[model samples]
Target chain A: MRLKLLGLAAAVALLAACSSDQDAAGTGSVTGATSATAPTTNAGAVRPGTRQDFEVNVGDRVFFGFDQYDLSPEARSTLDRQAQWLNQYRAVTIQVEGHADERGTREYNLALGERRANAVKNYLVARGVDPNRVGVISYGKERPAVLGSNEAAWAQNRRGVTVVQ
Target chain B: MTMSAFMTRCDRLARLAVLALAVLVAGAAAARAELRVDITRGTVQPMPIAITDLLGQGQSEGQIGRDISAVVSADLERSGLFKPIDKRAFIQDLVSLQQQPRFADWQVLRAQALVSGTVEPQPDGLVRVAFRLWDVAAQQHLTGFAYRIEPKAWRRVAHKIADQIYERITGEKGYFDSRVVYIAESGPANQRVKRLAVMDQDGENNQFLTDGRSLVLTPRYSPTTEEITYLSFFNNRPRVYLFNLETGRQEVLGDFPGMTFAPRFSPDGNRVLMSMAANGNTEIYAMDLRTRRTQQLTNHPAIDTAPSFSDDGSRIVFESDRGGTQQLYVMGADGSDVKRITFGQGRYANPVWSPRGDLIAFTRLYQGRFYIGVIRPDGTGERLITEAYHVEGPTWAPNGRVLMYFKETPSSDGRSRRARLYSIDLTGQNEREVVTPMDASDPAWSPLIP
Candidate 1:
């Protein structure tokens, strides 16, 4: 009941915040959700009725290749599941963060990351997810999922992750 | 040349260089290098110099003299144009040199040039500085200057003395009296905290402008003022902001509905050129700094960013993918006569126009490696200056004779990455690292301080 109330408050805030203003208070649930979910990296856990439910069961992130924004077959399969889960949670809107590896220049990587995020948005919208329910941002090479300079880290860093608000 | 070779073969060309120096200091001044490098011959050699401690009356003044002279030596040494002869080999004492520098004594140490100065502390709590630059080989006094400044400005005084020597010897405006602002990076790769940092061009007097509360990137110094314009992720909305160093106040450049980034200042410092990304389309925009009015320079469907202005602010060179790949394009300052400038063998990005208006520096990604290259504005005389696993952000010294960029080096296991700053000349030689306390990137060299 408490989480439901919080979700309702966030949904109201999101609607009142509208499409343009980047109000910091709009993501009340997201700020707490990240800290609670950061420690739960288990892949097999699939509990329902919580924010981690979407992250664990729906798989919030899709990876991309180096300097390549075109979705692969595996990424498409993941987005398909994400779109369904997002549609189910009517009050839960999401902000998709697109990231890139550190190999490219900062400005160019930003543009590349935007293309990736926009691609994911276009894919989810095509799958019948409401366009207004989804927001997009490109962190570029600033935020990395893993801390390494190797191919493994680079592969994980170049990704589009959906954050539930 | 390396240090050992510089010591052994230093005297061979001293006689021939005297005539060249005379012609350079007389008629070809301001457009020529008085140091060892001869651009026409494509040869690089650091001129040998002997720096002596400044004579002083009191103990504190003597301490200041030593500190000031050390800074001057370090400045010349870092330029890769002057090889300061070791002090252990000096035969002339400060007492004798203050009266009359014994040229044969310095010549025995293979010093082609000599610098001597003095420091005087005033009763009013101010300090006075006077310096002399002498051509040791020709036994002639080249330049001398005196300055009176507060004691807190000793580093600046030292830099000014170095600038006088550099200008008199090289026949070009000295870059010593300048500051460099860059991004000071820390934390892990995923959660990096970037702050704005500034220091002297020779890497002294370091200060952090921001406290690392928000992420800042690509800080550019105003060519005409003590202000910087950069992109900030404040409030989770990427926007361009102008920060005044004097007032410690930051103002958003404009209230664009989308991200405003890749910012640079015009040569006149009256406007800022940046990229505004709206929807899925990115284009270049120039905003009047005072009026906050913006004029879109490119109306392309593809990504267009990293816009830089020519010295006169009449033309802008930026990178765009309208040609199906990232390449540099030159357009008029009014967004007219758009023409591509780079036709190289790789994807070109991060195009920065040289301050002299003769060249454009960019990062070329080919296959997997990155190269920092310079190309003429007219799409000719393209040359690669340096290469690395990851190198980007080329900024020019105010004189336009040298360039500074950052290079990221991977750790042995390839799990961690370290980014550091480096400087290189237009001749593709004298590549030196500009050290910082922490990981650094996106360096912006300020104009010579007023």
Candidate 2:
């Protein structure tokens, strides 16, 4: 029984490490990338600069209008860049997270967030990215990128973020 | 057997009142008039009632009697049907339970009804409470009863007495003997800590059932049992959990691979209806508790969630976005013959069918404001009852004559928000704020406890 408990603890630690690595690849790469020429080392290696390059050159998220699930022209352009990035990093699976402002009910906002996430997923799939490589989750208004309640803050919070896993 | 004993005592009191009235009429030439009130039309003008502080019988100046009497008065006053008179205006001080109140003194204060009671502390940590209701004008006792309860349950005894008096005067069922289970929230706007909490209807005996380690939402009580079903974000997965209040035991409803939310118990408390999201689509599902069998009630491609059963458990009213936006829809229990009910300008969500089965209460969003409204089951007679900056999650009282919902007021700095519970009558009047210790939301009213 003690051995089994140790095995479970090790498994949980591994999962925790993997999740933190994914977070580092998404948000921590901007400052952690040591060199710009690291992509020339190996052909199949996951280049350390891949995430930073995508975030700096191509956007990571796209904003939406109030209570709207349809993508704007700029949002489509961002999805085009995101599709190209995902195709280049073929081994990378990405999760598209949808969010909403704090204006609607909690349950309805969840549904609206799902709609927004799926809209982005469909746009990426239509642009030739593998559909199986993309997953979606709706955080609703629970996790907001901005903390204010005004129009400017709301416009920033109502967005869809694509994170590589 | 206890009920029959009380009824017999009531009979003897009525006979004694008749005899006393006959002697008084024979001695005085003036005709004796019986003060009576016709309460059939409802309480437009609240009747003035005076509730005396219950005297301690076996103990000297016990604090329990005073506390019980105060709670009883507050319960009746909050109902909007009765106004408790100021105790300072009482001309005669109640010293014992057996002493009759001077009717002329109560009449001088213009009180329509009077309540007097006594409390006796027992040796085994139990207390005996006896109370009598009197008509001030008629100089006769209307009702009397006694209860033996533990000292900890004295508030419940007070609420029971208030419920009885309310029923006798209003011709309707009383909601005072009820409790509310809701999410007690605190912390900043960005990260709010919500825990499951239960308290009496007047915000007494507040107790937290869950630690604030996980995110919990929409705690609803079973109509027939002391169990609650809510969504918990435990282990980074949102699932529906059933919590037994009596034993403090909790179990996950099912081993679903996806997220389940917006759980509500069926009117019979035998089934749980919730929304499950799979493959980027959300649908409504129901599971029977006895058989552990799951049934998909809605197969819509759009988000169909917040399913609530009607009073009879034959039909379900839920919110669906199938028609391009969020709206209210009604369907059969077997998920047949779906019909859209609301065609208003704003979005409608969280449609809870009234306990009386006549109307459905829902939260509406329009023009950047939230409103709590009710509509008939047939999609007609829509009325927005209360409007606020942010209002959602309408739960009905057991009697279906009132609704309780949460309202949030945004701060000027936008860093902190205050959320509180508010209740309003069915006719859109008597809007009052229910006080809580801290910020609170997602109030679910329990059925009157047996």
Candidate 3:
């Protein structure tokens, strides 16, 4: 009976600590709770919260090569560098988008782009990234990197891009 | 000698009795196969039309003007819709190729409609042809246009005239000025190499789009744009993707948990309607673009695929086998109010709604014969448009005046096959093969890519 009481007391203390820290964080405050315990990794919840901050903001662009969904060796290296950068900003998630050149039809391109984005996802997962930390979608041929009809433009258009989640 | 003849007669009678018994047994086992189908006769009257031969600057212009005009007249006449009046019967001189026509002279010729045109030569050696469609009954200008094309394009110019006349009378758009996209097949049948091909509706100006590393099928174009959506076995998973003509970009669609096929654009160009197969049954789904949302439209356990939306996107026409056999069904875009549209003797597949919203074209299979037919939305006026050994996948020309479908013919080698694209007017006339550099199928007609 004494040991059971001790365990309950420890749990209460931890909950109190987490509540107080959430209060301090301001944006993630929890109300109606006893507030006197230490905080854990409460920010790692899988559910979406404060989606406005997760909007695809500017300066967070991704790139790919012509008619290829499989990332290039250089692309993988660049993504590795980006992963390191992401590690420093510990609170952010991301979305990966795949695209294709406009020579083909529309639906096929959409499926192709999805494959390319998933390729990036596979690489990131293999590199020890959390699968839930990334989401993927395909824009197909709807969006283009460059707006020209020549080969140079098409080569640039086939790509997968990373955006801030 | 008399005894030998009697023995031979007895032997022949015994053999005849045994043959008769065998015939009776075979007849009893023969399959009794038949379906009572009510097929209504379509209108046999040819569409009234007029084609005026363009006069040239002088006799020095030679046979070019007459030849071009004659070819156009013949094409229209062969369509079975138009009855082109004889050029010699033209009451008016229309002598000046560059001037407007005297409608009164055409009226005197008893032409219900009048096609008058002029031919001239540009300084760059190109031919400039001008044509106009006049409605003697309505007493107004129907359609008029001018084209500056190479001398070799004269035949196409002729086709354009016929297309315009058909559209003006029918209140539908003309399809003669468009092109068809199909898979060109070559090499041995088992190891056939298929490539993406594009050609004019009249079998002119054929070009290969893809080199055929992967298999492609069922290409469909945006009703108003140059974009196309088709099923490609590129990675061998059978996914749907988009190919853009202008930017030459290809992008894959959603990463479905299962195989995706039979994709088409919503009339508004804002969403894609497709079928995703899971557990051996296919269901229809729609994806909205502006917001990344997917909606499952049909939850039936049957094979519900090949969904085509009406012009306004309010309803969709698709093929389903919910009736124990493959037949066409019409339902609301959200998958409510399912109504059977075809009650024919055979199975119907590949139902494509016309751009004009007045007709639906489909492929029907019956008793070892394949047919292409069109029916109105209410299931009235059902008409079988074409019959062949094997025909499938009917696509409409932009104007909905012509249908382009593929036919497969048996080769000397039973295992080998040849596929070719053929086009015909909605009136079921003027059937001609759209020649490709190689065997082709799964044709999709694009709107004039200006």
Candidate 4:
């Protein structure tokens, strides 16, 4: 019962905190539930009882090859599928992060990763998603999926990932 | 004409046997190496170096030998200082004699020096690497060394060979075997968790020096490998900390009641020159590491930071806004002879004198752009190496051939920020990333490990 009270308090805090006039486009609010069971809603307003089961999902990541910022056919297809889901849910705005492998220089890779993120954003917009619904950033090999010095790890590092803001 | 003159000189010396051997052997040691040849300057003409693949003789098809030598060649070539000759142009396959090299074929390629080596596997899990440097024009063996290490150390062995070549040709020690200290970062933009990390110069064997409990920056390695002086925010207070790399002990540098940042070792490593900021103003101060006594070098009410020492440790070049704009200034170690050295189109900061006492590398901000540039001590011959969105904080390699610095990527939300470290030749070729687990920045190169 005390845990339930704490959950309700958290929900109230989130709602009160999020209502401070900043959130305009009406992305769904994550409240009350733990980070694992944070509800993802299709509408901009807060929805009750929409909390999914508590399983922390490791989100899927997108990959790039070498110095190329243009997405491969496979990357576009994946983004198209993601766009379809995004279009179905107008409330969700994704933070698209671009990354590069540990091969090239840092600043150049930062620009390259930004171009890659822009490529994904351009694709999403072309697929009828709102440009405002997506935000782009470049990590520039600062974050790697794997820590080995082998090619396998490097391939995983050359990637972009989308996280819910 | 240059080649003919060199060749004619070689021919004349060849006729005099004893004179030829003495001059050739010593000249082999002191060849026409490029510019500063110290921890401050880089090569203008790519090092005229050549390395031939070691031809192995056995049923075992020499793949390991080829791979090892190739790794060595790649390491040297990536430095942008050496022009490793193409294997296809090799006139000789001297795998039969890695120790006693034949210098004629290498000379024909106009390669001033040649690196020939052999890799042999022992009954144990060790590999014996024997390499020799050949003075192509002088036609003499410069120096040879051999070592036995684990198979995984083949890459390090390659680096060692390149080090020997660099030292022999440049008449100075090589920094290829050294490590770089940097701030490894992670998480978000505003609340970044930074840990001190050390990695090989080639971006391998990276390990964290500090845990993520505190934020660290501007790690400067002492001349001795035991200690480092860097800025740390251990308990939310920013101060300079002296960390012992061996014992993992850390102590605050001085009892200063202000923030101390941009700490660097003196040339002799006895004192640390840093900028201590009190109120809104900052000044340069030197603190003796052995004694906790501090000496104030600058009495500026402006933002005077990023203090660096000259090779002789008698003077310091620092960045100050005393002239209403950020510019490089040189002053005596006793805070006398204050003379401005840079007055150009931009504002310059972080003026680091090359370890060789020739050039100073600095970060320049001009007209809404950031640049990494090098200039003579007199502020002439200023050359901008790279320009980026936000590049800052350059540290010299032990040999001063390359510089490592950090750059930040702009985020749309200003929340999802990223920063990472990079290294480039002074000539701006072979630019590459120094990989870390998370975001990294503020790289400082350590002295050669051995």
Candidate 5:
């Protein structure tokens, strides 16, 4: 009880010190409050159809290999889970954003990203998901999730991310 | 040269002589065309040139005169064909040169070409400029011109004078009076703000077309230079958009079912050739601007992008993966007689046909490095001009004598990368970085402004 009160006091003091700087503390306090009353808020906070729930529970993205649109067994399994989750929510439509690593040229990378996205969409349709409920976009190496030029960064960058609105 | 072409040039010279006869009488040897610049070879010894300041009688006049003279000198020196000598080495002033050019004074400094001019402030808020080009070694007058323009148009007037000098000496058109459209980028790598921008070829008068609210890419100028076509991700849908400079009217090119990008103008500027991705396949298409009709050029399942038309509009050169790897191919404008043109070791893409129609510029990616290269139309005489960690999107000057491309260099242990624009001639020498306000890419050079 005493620690929770101190944490709240610190967050309030942080807000008063600098409102702009409290962006970091804002999230820290939320996490602290949730942990304090873990049992009640944990179940109530799980909005099943929310983007956070979809990302945490349903796996909203899959990875790809270097210069290849062919999905690996692991990526296929992730898409399988995605299809199952998406089928449960019939009213939701998702856009699959196809991305490529920065090792290639712009125009060609765009094509490669398109191929990867269609590969994901085809997998989902084959797994009993409605084709019309899904759309795809190829970012073509324009946006990267990571900011380094190494292999680890490239591996994370080559991906197909699903978003729900 | 053909007999008709030679005769046509002779007729032009005759006309010039007739027009300039009022200023002064021409000697017999003055009519002979000499001091030619051979641009065919890969290396050249720059011809020494002497550019005298345009004598202005007043303060503002002299300032404009000096500015105009400096611009002309910079243009000539940047072409890598002439070396403008230092002004401190001058023995004869513009007054003396206008009165009587002493060939011995210029010859002593090894200046084969000498330029002398004057700026006269007109009565009605205009500037009257007259200039002369002399061949010092031959001791003969080459050419001269006079113009009346507003003081605000001094930069353009300088470029025009340089164009005249270049045309008289090299027998080709000049690309100084031109503009380039590019994508200016800022912010982090993941959340970048790419805006469409246009600037003078010398990196002046820059203005942003888009407010950087939406992501834009790959802007290309039409032949008339009055319109630009580019790809924009507006409202989360990528489409091709056209902006008219004169009217400030913007519109989508056409309603396509998929993403449309890499749109380039044909020789006549009536149609835009671009690539569209749909149904898990990418193909090339041409849309006629007037009728709102699109013609699918490539029907292959493989990727076909970066289509550029030839100077005569009879053929096109593009990159296709139909041959298992990204290679360049030539096809008729109607999508017939498709022939593979590149057999090099690397994957070649971004093929732009030269304005002269003699060579095609392309980007080749091999072993993790990119190269800007040129090859013949018949798939012969391949030459790699510049290489870097990442360089692509080569655009041609109006004269086809120089190429501008974007190069991305890594800084600080390959964590952050920066893209900058660069230009290099066919000779592979005199490579220069074009300065910009921010990181830039996807440079598209426009034809000389009409």
Candidate 6:
């Protein structure tokens, strides 16, 4: 019963956080919002949302399979939302960071990470984000989000994160 | 003439002949006084050697003298070629630089060779070190040398003395008088902070070159200069940076539109080879330092990186996945005759050509383990030197006698992974850990400094 109460509290807190995010977007810039093709319904603001908002609402990251850079359907869906959020904030520029698991040579993983980041950038550009606004950087296996050598940690580490600049 | 006169003349001729013979024998003995030991094969058991504490002259007894001797002893010990005998077994104590060692006593202790030296403080605030090598079996002096240097460089002086002895005995160049530049890592597994560090080959005089605010990797030393080319992640943009040790200056290699990494200096240190990615395709590029002009070496759609030049700078070996899985390839300096050099079941990467131009060291991964190996340029006589759970980034010592690489042990609890540096001889023997203050990797040994 205590676990259920805690779950309810967490849901309420999440809803409150999302509503506050929408309120901030609504009061932000209305001019940039007017210029975008489809402004977010809750916010008539044109300014780009915070990186935290993009991560929480639009999904800031996508994962790839082992030694592979091709995007999956789930990854494509995440990129689509990222594109919509990027389009909503016309004035903001973003940098895509590609990372890899610690199973390969440092130099080779560096190249693999580059391919992964560029794959995301290409997908987002096809989904209507400007190519000039999106830059890519690869950290290789140096900055792993997860630390373990297990499959779970490796899967989480092989990801691309988009950050607003 | 009478018979008695004839007998007297014959006796006088005999005396003259004896005198001539004696003079010739004396001259030959003088010429052969300097003993020599021919080392035709590496010893299974290290030859026993005794290095006495170097006596200090006109100074505080044996302070610096003992320190230098300890460094020299440690260097010879780490080489796995010499076993320093205990001083307690010595029958005769070292007293003065001018006195000759009682070779019979060293022979009694079963020492094959003896090293004795003296340190004297000079009037110009420098220390003069003089050492002599003795062959116990021959009971003769083999070689000796003297040098005057600042007291602060005592360790280098010791290394120099050790190198001289090593070369004289082994008939090969010694790598003691060298430095290594590597990436020093610290902190938790997830948030590792790596910095560029330089130190003596035996893990002394360590100094960090970078502040760890930016991540650094794969520092390659120039064969002819005190400069290194490494990859850095400053401002979240990964680029190749060239750092000069003497000048304490750092600069980005080129103004690329995208990321540039995996850098190495040409054999002559005139150019740098690196990989640059654009529009998701990574290719090898070389830049001439004198003209500041860049040239693309590989124009393939597949990734071609980690380009290491041969000693003559005529060819390069690199890793690529153009044929499906990662494999090594050799090509001319002009990017012609690109032939795959690895065709085994596993993937190979980071092919570094030996300074002797005979073998290329590389990292191999197969069946969930990583290996450090060497192969001929023609992909013949492939030999795996060492294996670990995860090993990569093999760099050759200046003499090409040893290869240094990094090994990582995975954390079972997912939070405390450990990495360390290790080295092995080219013959796959004498595998030893190069202890660092913290986790270290990507070691690049500098050529013997002038």
**Predicted structure with the largest TM-score when compared to the true one:** 5
Error of 6 at B204 (Å): 0.5
Model 2 TM-score, 2 decimals: 0.83
Sort the predicted structures by DockQ, highest score first.
1, 5, 6, 2, 4, 3
**Better model by lDDT: candidate 1 vs candidate 4:** 1
Quote the lDDT for A125 in model 5.
Answer: 93
Please give, for residues A65-125, the per-residue lDDT of candidate 2 as tens digits. Answer: 9888889988998899889878877887877878798998888777778778889999999
TM-score of each model, in listed order: 0.86, 0.83, 0.58, 0.63, 0.89, 0.85
Stretches > 4 Å off in candidate 4: A1-165, B1-68, B85-95, B99-113, B119-128, B135-140, B148-157, B170-173, B411-418, B428-430
For model 5, residues B237-264, the per-residue Cα lDDT tens digits are 8888998775567788899999998889
Shift in Å, residue B408, candidate 3:
1.5
What is candidate 4's CA lDDT for residue B35? 22
Instruction: Please state the Cα-based DockQ of model 5 relative to the true two-chain complex.
Output: 0.32
Candidate 1, superposed: residue stretches over 4 Å from native: A1-49, B1-41
Runs in model 3 lying further than 4 Å from the true structure: A1-165, B1-71, B83-114, B119-129, B133-143, B147-160, B168-172, B289-292, B343-345, B378-381, B427-430, B447-450
- Candidates ranked by lDDT, best first? 5, 6, 1, 2, 4, 3
lDDT against the true structure, per candidate, is 0.78, 0.77, 0.64, 0.67, 0.81, 0.79
Which ten-residue region of model 4 chain B has the weakest summed lDDT?
Answer: B13-22
Full candidate order by TM-score, most accurate first = 5, 1, 6, 2, 4, 3
Residue-level lDDT of model 2, residues B1-450, one tens digit each, is 322322222221111111111111122212123333333332457789999888876544357678778988998887766789999888887783348788888888899888888888767666777777777876767665677665655677788789867765665677887879999998765466789998778887678989988878899989853789998877656789998776688889998877788999999989999998865688999999999889999997888999999999999999998997889999999899999999999799999999889999999999899999999999999999999889999999888888999999988878568899988878787778899998999999988865
- CAPRI tier of model 1: acceptable
**How displaced is residue B249 in candidate 5, in Å?**
1.9
CAPRI-style grade of the A/B interface in model 6: acceptable
Worst 10 residues of 6 chain B by lDDT: B13-22
- Residue range B1-450, candidate 4, lDDT tens digits: 322222222221111111111111344435344322342454356666678765544434266567667867877776666778887887765645554556776777878777776666667645566677776777667765676655555555667678877776656667776767788887643235779887777777677878877767778888765577897866645688998766578998888765677789998889999876543356889998788689999986665778899888988998877887678999998899989989897678778888878889998877656888899988789999988767887888877767888887756633254678888877776678777777888788877654
Which is the better candidate, 1 or 2, if ranked by DockQ? 1
Report chain B TM per candidate. Answer: 0.91, 0.88, 0.74, 0.80, 0.93, 0.90
Candidate 4 chain A — worst ten consecutive residues by lDDT sum? A25-34
Better of 1 and 2 by TM-score: 1
Best by DockQ: 1
